[model samples]
Target: MENLHNDIYPAIDPSVTKSLHQPGKVVLITGAGRGLGRSIAEQYAYACVASIIICARTSTELDEVEASINKINSAVKVTKFQLDVTSETAVKQCFEAVKEKEGRLDVLVNNAGASLEWVSIDESEPGKWWNVMEVNLKGPYLLLQAFLPLLVETARSNNTVVDVVNISSIAALLTFPQSSAYQLSKAALLRLTEFVDVEYKDKGVNAVGLHPGGVVTKLSENNDAIRPYLIDTPALCGGFTVWLTKGARTWLGGRYAAVTWNVDKLLSMEEEIVKGDKLKVKLVV
Candidate 1:
């Protein structure tokens, strides 16, 4: 099999021309303190997004990301919130805070995730499996439930589409050894993405799942099971995310995409992708 991580994709360079400009659009990214999440936030800052709400469990990390984004563009409003996405109450309060401050939310990136144990099914404990599910799957569900009202209202009032980008993984599609928990969670996440798109597309809310490639992040670097694979830069996912937000790509809702795939190449095949029902999760009969 071809190595999925071997492919090179475009990176988001601050010096290059910005392709996504959401001048007054407000975006909220969970787990945005570092790694791919931080890269995503920085990409948005360069695109001149009006307000960016970054949330994570650590205040110090959040502070650093906020400061970094501010240094890049002083005008880009950065709000750092210490949040544990696994908590329903915290998710509710965070959304309420964003509602009070921004009046609306234009984009939501459910990027918080964890892989507790990489052991095979026989060796995996229930507690460890549940931990992965709670963070990767349930966290996004709670976030969507809490933020949907604001997203719907914003899309209706503004005559624009709201976006929900779930940071999923290629593990959801391929069967890899000793990755039961992480793979299950990601698979369910893709289903949740599809359900959100089907239920809310008519209301102007679009949702999609993104496989961020095998990026060398703290998560992957620490996991001995996956550290040896060829990895892509976090900027690949960051740039692809910005491209996903553009209105022209609304048809991509309900689909799953990989950052390893070139954005321009993906866009060029948009019509065929939609018509063929490609890039969507389906059970192979």
Candidate 2:
């Protein structure tokens, strides 16, 4: 029998998936092959997103995710691209493919990561830091650069906005001596989020760093020592991310946030979760 790494019990709520109903909106997700990415993709597919572009390094893995979505709703359009997000050429090609297939792109979820390994900084080698930076920071930056045109076009042509949600970590803000490289990259990712917000705010493109508080996944399951402290699940993170994109235009952007905190804002009625497919907007008029 294969080893079953059960870091979290499944408590998936499909109701959280109702945010992606823009009729013809297009979404592209990195690292959609497994873990939280798979969960996020499942929820988006369930919401009847117009088009979902799933990318990962393994063609077989991408195919698996695509096939799984097809099983749930065969009419939902899912395009798979074999990609290593760290490569600028690959990122450019993937964005081009999205432009070709979808004509306009509406959302991007930067979920690809490289800092899955857990080891004391003292025990880690030099290449570890480089690998983490390459995937976590460089990849997302390249994706944003390559896709900015499509995002701008989407906003202008369709009367819809573009969202870039960067999946960061609490480790970025809190000290985690075990993985310094991961910490540094995620912190920089938050900065990148700020830059995106500043540069694109006037253009109607919203970007933010979302810290999915300790979601159980392959990285967390592989490390037995730190798994106990994590409280959130992939499904919860996925659900929150989809909703975040739906309403991030009104919510403050360019800062780090978590589901636990944002959901509390909803519960306390500081922010109202809008009904139907429209984004929640604060009344200023």
Candidate 3:
């Protein structure tokens, strides 16, 4: 899909009532300490979500985001977890904590990821390459396992839909040199998204794989090859996420989206996209 806007416009900004204001939802985000993760959390705060749970490896980063959330919306309850998303026990414990306290979870943003040195399979450190898969692929799976019950229950109780946004990448669809571990992990995530939607859509759960635009984050900054392409604002992905989740966007379930794509344009193309199964991973793609 062609991108109509590269940055935040009036239509998708978190302050846009028609597009972004969805109050009282409970959201949990992994990697919420910094970069696109923090951006997504902040946008949810702007939407006046009832509570937000943020998890990251660094306690200091979590503290900063909590303070930022407080400034954005003091009424918004903020929970912090110093977590490794790849740890099954930790993820399950986080799940228990949220289930006990919130009793519901409306959205899960699987944003925690790892990217080692950009080296080819032949040159890559075996341990480091495997770590990317652990964080990128297995991490989301752990989260889904831990949280899907509460998400499904939340939907059942509300008679509405909940969401799982797997933060995949453009690399999932395209190819590049020296990106096998990262790229392949993200690619598999799209299939995982599809599987989740098929299994749970009738039960009121939707999952989507997303590319969070090219932003100059701490992560992206380390990749010299993509420096010139990191032209997008951090707010673009943040606001796009708020827009995507405002309502039951089951139409977009089990597909892919890029924050750089104009959301209104995507909505307009919905019928065509659904009919042709566009934006999905397949043999042609």
Candidate 4:
């Protein structure tokens, strides 16, 4: 089972999946300018969502993404924001803007993340080492702070399940040398997911930590050691995310999911997962 992996399947395919279509739901995706974020945004459009809030630091990329969404589904209302997720002022403003315009948010994808050169702590530049935390960790924290209230409100009034997808990495489970910043941040994020789920499960908010498969992108190309594992594509991330939000997957709340896991198998193991409290961050005895 350790070596096994899976890819995209019909159940999660937004373009053809009937069960996964979100007709009236609004979704917000960070780092949507390109790569996996772009793919996730596109999948939502294909899922027939009512609107998509696409955010990134680059206006040009957002413009291109907006245009692409228009081509994919002109009916999808696309909103673009040139956002730097690490900036508190920007995140709060984004929250206010979304709250004002949409009045509610059904999905928030904390997909904006950063990484730094693999240098030992002793030799690492303080700014560079900590910047990764600011982007990968602090950004999501601020977003959560700013938007969670809206999510909770939406859930209470609408009586529906809202999702928060924190994009974690497989590295969170590894102990690779010189990869401390990214690993620790992701590991902490899983705990944050737990806190969010436990705190708001009764209110219909489901927070999930997801490990998107190793899809090679601009942010990842510089690393040579992990190059071979970059065999997956952005569609896998997008499709799996759709599946995660297809309905009220409360059983999966506060858990870790990977795109490489076969959805059918994953579903079949729900009983085992729930009974054993699996897919969570824990220490081995």
Candidate 2 differs from the real structure by a C-alpha RMSD in angstroms, to one decimal, of: 7.2
- The lDDT of each candidate is 0.86, 0.74, 0.90, 0.90
**Candidate 2 has what TM-score?**
0.84
lDDT of 3 by residue, 189-266 (tens): 989999999999998998999999888988789898988989888788888888888789999999999888887788
- Provide the clashing-pair count of each candidate structure: 0, 0, 0, 0
Question: What tens digits encode model 4's per-residue C-alpha lDDT throughout 1-285?
Answer: 533354566778988877789999989999999999999999998999999999999999999999999999999999999899999999999999999999999999999988877888898898888888899888889999999999999999988999999999898889899888888888888888899899988889999999999988988889887889898889899998888988899999999999888888899999999999999998879
Per-residue lDDT of model 1, residues 1-285, tens digit only: 232333334333432655567689899999898988998998888879899999999999999999989887889999988999999999999988999999999999999989865787888898878999999999999999999999999999999999999999988997888888899899999999999999998989989999987878777777876777636777777777877886636789899998777666677798999999998888678
> What's the C-alpha lDDT at position 42 in model 1?
87
The residue ranges of model 1 lying beyond 4 angstroms of the native Cα positions read: 1-15
- Provide the RMSD of all predictions against the true structure, rounded to 1 decimal: 2.4, 7.2, 1.4, 1.5
Candidate 2 per-residue lDDT over residues 17-109, each given as its tens digit: 344444566888898999878877877776677788898897888888998888866767999988998999999888877888788888888
Compared with the true structure, model 1 gives a TM-score of 0.94
**TM-scores of the models, in the order given:** 0.94, 0.84, 0.97, 0.97
* Candidate 2, residue 34: lDDT: 90
197: Cα error in model 2, Å: 0.2
> How do these models rank on lDDT, best leading?
3, 4, 1, 2
Which consecutive 10 residues in model 3 have the weakest lDDT in total? 1-10
